[model samples]
Target: MDVVVIETRPLGDRSYLVHDGEVALVIDPQRDTDRVEAAAAEADVRITHVAETHLHNDYLTGGLILARAHGAEYLVSANDDVAFDRTPMADGGTVQVGRLTVKAVATPGHTHHHLSYVVSDGEDQAVFSGGSLLYGSVGRTDLVSDEDTEDLTRAQYSSVRRLAAEAQPDAALYPTHGFGSFCSSGPASSARSSTVAEQQESNHAFTDADEDHFVRELINNLTAYPSYYAHMAPANRQGPGPADLTVPESVDPAELSRRLADGEWVVDLRHRVAFASRHLQGSVSFEYGRGSSFTAYLGWVLPWNQKMTLVGSEEDIEKAIRDLSRIGIDSPDAALGTDPSALAPGTAVVHYPRVGWAEMLHGRSAGDVVLDVRRTDEYDAGHVAGAVNVPLHELLGRMAEVPAGTVWVHCATGYRSGVAASLLQRAGRQVVHVDAKYGPS
Candidate 1:
């Protein structure tokens, strides 16, 4: 058996294409099904099945659409009260595709109906642990509901133990979460690969003998996830349609000006340094590039379903649209290019100063405010002395709380502070972006 890992790095998740050379099965695919199809084609395998471990809370699943397109069986947990039809899989149920035998194991943790798939040929086996039994941690159980958090966390502990007990020690452990996804409850191991034995030897689920302590620790450590996550499960339950990755109609200088004047979300996708150097007066900076979480943070901060306009080159806009679509933010309008003044004629182009930690520290004054735009938990862990905290996700709604002063904003990394700086600038506040890592100078 051969497995191909399809990584969606922007969201920090992985989907798998498992095959026995001729027939393949896709596990936990994202909304963009083209990537799965492309992987199948490249491997010279026919996709015979598409399976979802649960109704995901992170991104829309492409299982239904991919199954229909390939004439393959779509498998979902039998207990899920979804609107669409699916091959309902019960615990201990089995299916065969070519030489591979797939067994469904009931592992309710991340969600009540979650299942982990065990796929094996005659000699080799692998586990497709969608949200259960991660590399070093387990999927966050709070996504189900606030009321069910404790109960599900207990179940999560049991579920991971069960996976470790049932699967062979040598079997390859492939989890869909825990690869830098918010779905992970704790710090996940950075190891590229792990086995059941490796997990049993070091995973907290096994090392921590006290279940009560385990549950409490897991619950307490859970941090704030993206605000857009609340929409994913509902959309998945209704069976979302294909993602429209096509670029929206271009807005000329006049139309762009009108959108900006009318208070529409015109997002500028450039380097934060470039955005700070020069940008449209009202356009917000959500720089789209490597290591920048343009999709998640933008979707989180922006009002849900708000009509947004992108400002960047055609390539950047296209990439931004695709990333946004994965989180169900689709068909956003675009203004193609980086020159802020040219994009909106007669409108004021704005600029802000970006400083490092040293500059921010040395230039501190009695009236100047240091705004820490990280999450509450992140701020609680450590922060700049006397820095006022209003997380980036909550900044839009609580802008009034920010003190009157020249604000110097910073996050653990500068990506979020860059965004915060732009928002502050848009709101007519004097701002300096601390565009550097947070630590000793």
Candidate 2:
């Protein structure tokens, strides 16, 4: 048996393609089925089974459509209250795929009905741990509900132990979350691969035997997750269809201006520096390129189901469409170009000055406000002295609270700051983007 990883880096998750020469089983697939199809085609294996670890709270699952298209069985936990038909996989149940055997192990905690699949070829075995046993940590327990957090945290501790006890000592460990994913409770091991034995030696869940201490530590360390996660489980439960990757209708300068005038979202997908130099007056900066958390941040900042327009090069716009579709944002109108004058003729194009922490510190004015747009937890850890804290996620609703001044906005690595600066500029604040990594200067 061979296990292939399908990485979705923007969401910091992975889906797997497990095959036994002729047949394949896909676990925790994202909404885009083409990626999975391409992988299966390359491997020259027939997809005979598609399994979901749980009702995902990150991205919509492609398991349902992928299964239907290939005439494969769709496997979901029997305990979940989903709307569609599926081959209910109860704990200890087994499914055979050619020479491989898949056994469902009920490992609740990420969700109440979460299951980990242990696949074996009668000799070597691998565990698809889903959200349970991650590299150095596990999935966050607070996503379920505040009322259930304590119970789930305790359950997570037990679940990790249960999976470790049941699986072979050397079983290859694979997880769906924990590669810089918000789903993970804390930082994951950077090692490329891990096994049950290695995790047993290193993973905190295993190293800390006292369940009470483990539960408290995990809950206390839990930080804020993306605002868009609330819609994922509900959408997955309803069995969403394939993503709409069709290129949005191209809009002219007049239409783009009208959308901007109507207060519709006009996202500019340019480099942060380029966007800071010149952009459409009312356009919001959500740079779509390397090193940018384009999809996650955009999905988090934008109101759910809001009709929006994209402004960028054709390549960026195309990729942005695909990225947005993964988070259930589809069919957005687009305007192709970087030139603000060409894209929104005769409108007031704007620019903001960008600086590093040292430059801002050296050139400080008494009236200049240092605004930290990182999360509350990040602000608590350490931040610029006297920097006002308004997490990027909460900034939209609490704009009035930001003290009136020439705002110098910053974040850990300038991504959130770029977005915050653009929003503040659009709102008519005199803003400067501190486009540099945060550190002691």
Q: How would you encode candidate 2's per-residue C-alpha lDDT over 15-115 as one tens digit per residue?
A: 99999989999999999989999999999999999999999988889999999999999999999998988999998999999999999999999999999
- At residue 78, give the lDDT of candidate 2: 96
Candidate 1 lDDT = 0.91
Residues 1-441, model 1: lDDT tens digits: 999999988888899999999999999999999999999999999999999998999899998999989999999999999999899998888999899999999899999989999889988889999899999899999998899999999999999878767678899999998877888887689887898889899999889999999999999999999999999999999998999999877798998998888888999999999999998889899999976877889989989998889999999999888888899998999998778888888888889998888998898788999999999998998877878999999998999999999999999989999999999888889999999998734
| Residue 401 accuracy (lDDT) in model 2 | 85
> Per-candidate TM vs. native?
0.98, 0.98
For each candidate, what is the lDDT?
Answer: 0.91, 0.90
